[model samples]
Target: LKYIYLNAGKINYVSNLFFFQKDILLILKKYLEKQDTYKCFEILKTFEKKLDIAFEKEFKNIIYIYLVITFERIEKGYVILKKNNSEFLKNTLYYKVIQKDIFKNNGVYMYEALHLSEYFLSGYNSENFYEDRFLIDSFICKLLSVLKDIKIRNLINNREFLEEVIEYLRAAIYRVKNNFILNSEIKLDEIENKIFIEILQYKIKMNTYLNEPLRDEEFMMISRIIYKHLIKQKKEKIKLKEVIQIIQKNSKNCYSDLIAKELLELYPNLIENDIDFKKQLGLLDIVTEKNIKFTRCVDIKELIDLSFNDLYDNSFIEVEFTESIHKMLEDKKYDYLDSENMIIFYGKELKYKKELGVSIFFNESVMKIDNKKIKYLILLSNVDEYNYLGVSRDLQKIIESVKFKELEKLNSEKDVMRKFEEVIQGGESGF
Candidate 1:
């Protein structure tokens, strides 16, 4: 029978530690052909929500595997055998709700249904998971609120760590509710702040989940997370203050410039305090202001008349971007350009790296390249190897924008720069 054959394949599949053997893979592929993946995902998402638990982030493949196996078995009339005398639990609200809501139409029998429901609740009910989630959320909220009360609001602004703490509490709550005590080498006394411990203990006692206090291991882990987070916050503040002082001084030294650049990247919101400093930080962005140029050039002949030296820091020469030249540049085989008499390159060809600076030739009149007329040429050369990639990506986006084309017709540098800023601000693309 097909059911027996599939069961034998499944046994092999499980024996291989869930790695799909060729036969099982074939069966899964056949099963998935008639199944909607999205539907399976929806059921999986529903199950997670009902249980108030998440699978691992990359759980889709595993979910689909299990779903395929389970459904295929059911399709072949291989429902789980109902266990005798478990009818009392089958009548509970948790079991009833899950059965009705999740598996009512499915032919998953009593044994399977009971096991599925029990996987989430253990001996408890659905209400327990709901209450546990609420209690955990309230605990985190109150702890954060206490920080606010003590005027330590700045540390609370570390949203990344705050989210980590929230997720940690969620896991801790699950463990505590299930009476799964985590065994850890961490000691509660290791935390230096007695006041912090007392505050945490008070918060824990006040907002206990499921009539159980968090185990010593869980308590110490949570305390360590908070303590480390606070220490990191203090260090960051000191670093920021030092960097700001170095930048605020009337010095244009390399050391100060480097620190300013790093600080700007780490705390971009600091730009709100100083507009001029923000403009200086603009170089940190892929599109540097000094590199953009608006010019009038109708043909290749007109290129000679343009002041290439004033436009870019690197020397410029016009050369055809031949297949060999492009290949040589891509392979980083720079020996071909070793001759002093080698021709210089223009803006659009700068990624080939004959030069090192930014140049945007926003030509008012169309220029001919390989006998094809072009509106603009973007030349992005950078000492940083990865910088060209970023600049090219931004340039490609600008070229794709209809607004950028309109700016080209106007031939206004201001409008082009404003459009760049708009893109940087993550405004609507249509604007």
Candidate 2:
């Protein structure tokens, strides 16, 4: 067995003729076992560098597996290398890369490896692969947690696809756990949040009934309206039934590609394009068919702010904290009006019974004021930093307080938060 020793700068030296010879590998391992701990790593680096130099030119046949362990040095960027020279290689690739695409100086790892990650995720910035097992495990722990989001989970819709993705992630995780004995000090809060969000999305996709019966005219109006809305928002690939539900509020929007594609998979038919239908209408003048004027805005800010006008009516939803409810608020426009003493509670409150409450605002802030000094607990809008503190008695009193010059001059959002703290601090209710 010819063992290959990982030499210094061998990666730079070897061009394109590198091959993994198990016999050579066995010899190198024997040599490393005889050397000191410090010298063991030197042996590995020498082999890696040598292989890099050899695989730069001509077609090369080498080892089938290049396992890497990334740790502290490169933010845990690890990689696994495999040969791709035939039909089997094409099928194995996460991403396809034709030969003509590799004309640059940083040929193999830089361009080729990155493209390959589209199907397989070994690590980020995988240039820092080394023999350090400990470092690899630590980073892999964080990565697996982060990548557990809906985007990753949704990548595999069915059982087969799910199995494939799990297989890749599992291999990476297993390699780190077994090879690199790194510390697992990742944030639990983040991991839980991501998992919850992923699950919620999965549930939504797996279950929801999205529409109702409507006249052909109403259906056409809905289709046009949905097209206009999605176009205005510049959103694409949205479910047709979801768009339809916006027009039919009573219907549930849970249609799936497997169950039904709705408008996306339907025959084309326009209401106005049919001439025979128009002739059947005897009382055409009495039938009102007014086209509603639609407004289109390209500015995201304007579009978001367009949704902010609902905070004055005291119409808000109560959110409980259990079952990862916080994730349900994503991609929504709601004002959370939190006062020091509001009756609503959201997250920590739901679990283990804490004071973390969530008052989703659809209208005016809801808080009952008595003697509490609004301290610091307040609502935050992801859209912007605007927060509405529950008024002493509603917007009317708030307006009056400002008019009477009783309320001190302050930033609106700041004033709201402060007042919210005061109300929560006090033990009062109602306007």
Q: Candidate 1's C-alpha lDDT? A: 0.48
TM-score computed on alpha carbons, candidate 2? 0.16
Q: Find the candidate with the highest TM-score and give its number.
A: 1
Q: What is the alpha-carbon lDDT for the whole of candidate 2?
A: 0.28
What are the per-residue Cα lDDT tens digits for candidate 1 across 135-216? 3434554565566655556545354456677667666766665455565455545453553565564565435422466665
| Tens digit of per-residue lDDT, candidate 2, span 257-333 | 32233343342221111111121111111111111111243432232233222211122222332222233223221
Error of 2 at 151 (Å): 30
Q: Candidate 1 deviates by what RMSD? A: 22.3
Per-prediction TM-score to the true structure, in the order listed: 0.29, 0.16
